[model samples]
Target: MLRLLFVGDVYGKPGRRVLAAQLPLLRPDFDFIVVNGENAAGGYGLNRESFDLITGAGADAVTLGNHAWHHKDITALLNDPRLIRPLNLPPGTPGRGAHTFEVSGVRLTVVNLLGRVFMDAAHNPFLAMDELLAQPDLGTVFVDFHAEATSEKAALAWYLDGRVAAVIGTHTHVATADSRILPNGTAFQTDAGFTGPLHSIIGADPDGPIQKFVTERPHRFSVKDGPAELNGVKLELEGGQAVRIERYHYEEGGDGSAAS
Candidate 1:
């Protein structure tokens, strides 16, 4: 079986810290690793330094979301084969939406796609996926559907069932409990969750979000400090099908106590 670990969005410095600390302990058990790092730079967008840190921590590929281009300087970094952006972006956009890697002698393709509901304008993800699948020799496939609505994520998972090995949602930052193998052997999870501050508002300082919610006004937010967690899912695939999927969560306290 080909074992793959998909980590959710890395919020900021805290996320990067926990990832660097935990991944080494977790890497030996998996054949390949993929991380969602759109917010790795400063809870906004990725940068060269953040990319290096993630890959140095054992990530084979880093997937991005709507914030993929938040850092204008990242355009050049996008050319790296290890980075993946949303496939539904306008044509001629720099960076690829999917990349393939050889893991344990098997070809594995990792795809990143953005959802349309309540999100920035982009090409239709469904049709974009159709075009992607039409290409030759995809081998075993995995998709990081960075989207907001759970319904949209589920719909795409069901639509692509039996075609892709797994579909794990991102962007929401909150972990979902509904992880299961679909009728056709594909693994599906509504969201993989974020890897960052566990006691804050989705990896950000709670005060800013709370203020914004209460006053209905913009408030500056910063990455939360203190305790953090690493969230992801582990998938086992065989014969181009998902055989099993399990959620992986590890939390570390401010005083250094850790839990799994």
Candidate 2:
């Protein structure tokens, strides 16, 4: 069985710091790993250095969300063939957001899709998913539906239940408690939370976000440095379907101690 570990959104340098420190220690547990990095660059978009850090930390592939294009530097990262944008985006969108590969003789396919409701103007993720599920050779397929609305995210899980191996949601930094296998063998979760600062405000400085809401003003947000956490899920797939799945929440140890 192939163990796939998928991490949640990384916020900023502090997020990157926690990611770098935790991933290496968790590598031996999984065969392939993925990370959602829509906010790795200063709490907005990911950058070159941040990309390198995450990939260096052992992400087989990195997926983006609505904020993927927030940083201009991503123009180059998208060209690398490893960095992926949303597959549900308009046809001309750059970077391959979906790909198929092999691990220990097992075939695996990963697709990254962005939700449309309450999101930026993008292609229909449902239609895009139809095309992906059409492939017959895929043994185990995984989808990262980066979206904002819970209704939309939940619908997609049911939509692809019997067809795909798993459907995971991202973008909402809050982790959802509903992680379970669908009747059709697909593992589902609304959100995987985040792998960044746990003590701060939704992965950013608490003050700025609070001030903005309180004052009704635009505030340039920043990452808050403090204790950190690595959050994600582990899924075991067999015969192109998930047999077991579990969510994870690991906080950085205080006083120089590490979390298990």
Candidate 3:
């Protein structure tokens, strides 16, 4: 059996903190780790330094979303062949959208995608996912459908039932309680949550966002620096079937967000 761990979106420094603190504890149990780094760069884009940090933190591969290009050189960085983008990108896009990994003789394939409705123009995720689903030599598969709507996430999970091991949603920092195994043997969740500040608002400074909202004034967004907590999902899959799905939240000392 191959164990797959998918981390929620990493917002900023706070997200980075818990990520670094928990990997050593989780390394022995998870063979492959995937993290969403789109928001790791000052809460907007994934910078080169952040990318290196995510990899250094035990991420076998990193996935990106709509905010992927927030950094300057991400276009060139995506060419390194290590990072993956949305599979539904228009023809001739730079980075790969999907790839396969080998772990303990189990072929694990991971695909990243962006949503349509209520999002920037991207290829149809459903069509893009179907294309990858047709590929062969597939043992276990994981889909990071970075999206904005919960309905979209759920619809995609149902569409991929019995074909892939898991269909996990990202992009939203808020954690959802819908993690479960589908009737068709696939694990699914609306969102894995985020690995960042607990005291702040939605992974940001609670006061900062609150001020911006209450005062109706433009406030410079900054990373919420407080207790950091790591959040994500751990899954066990064998022969393309998911046997278990779990959500994990870890904090640093007393500063991190309490587990729900």
Which candidate wins on lDDT? 1
In TM-score terms, candidate 2 sits at 0.95
RMSD over all Cα atoms, model 3: 2.0
Expressed as tens digits, the lDDT of each residue in 94-121 for candidate 1 is 9899988888789899999999899998
TM-score of each: 0.98, 0.95, 0.93
Per-residue lDDT over 1-260 for candidate 2, one digit per residue giving the tens place of the 0 to 100 score = 88999999988877898899889988999999989888898888889989999999999888888888888888878987567788877677778878777888998888889998888888889888898778687678889899999999999999999888899999988889999999999999999898788778888788889999999999977788887887898999988889998998888778535666
Candidate 2 colliding pairs: 139-240
Better of 1 and 3 by lDDT: 1
Off by over 4 Å in 2: 258-260
lDDT string, candidate 3, 1-260, tens digits: 88889998898987876787777667888889999887888888788888888888899888999988778888887875558778888899888898788887888888888988699999888888888778778668889989999999999999999999999999888889989999999999999888787777767777778889999998877788878777799998887989999988776767344454
Ranking by lDDT: 1, 2, 3
Which residues of candidate 3, in runs, are more than 4 Å off? 215-218, 255-260
CA lDDT, every model vs. true structure: 0.93, 0.87, 0.84
- Judged by whole-model lDDT over C-alpha atoms, candidate 3 comes out at 0.84
Candidate 3 lDDT at 150 equals 95
Best by TM-score: 1
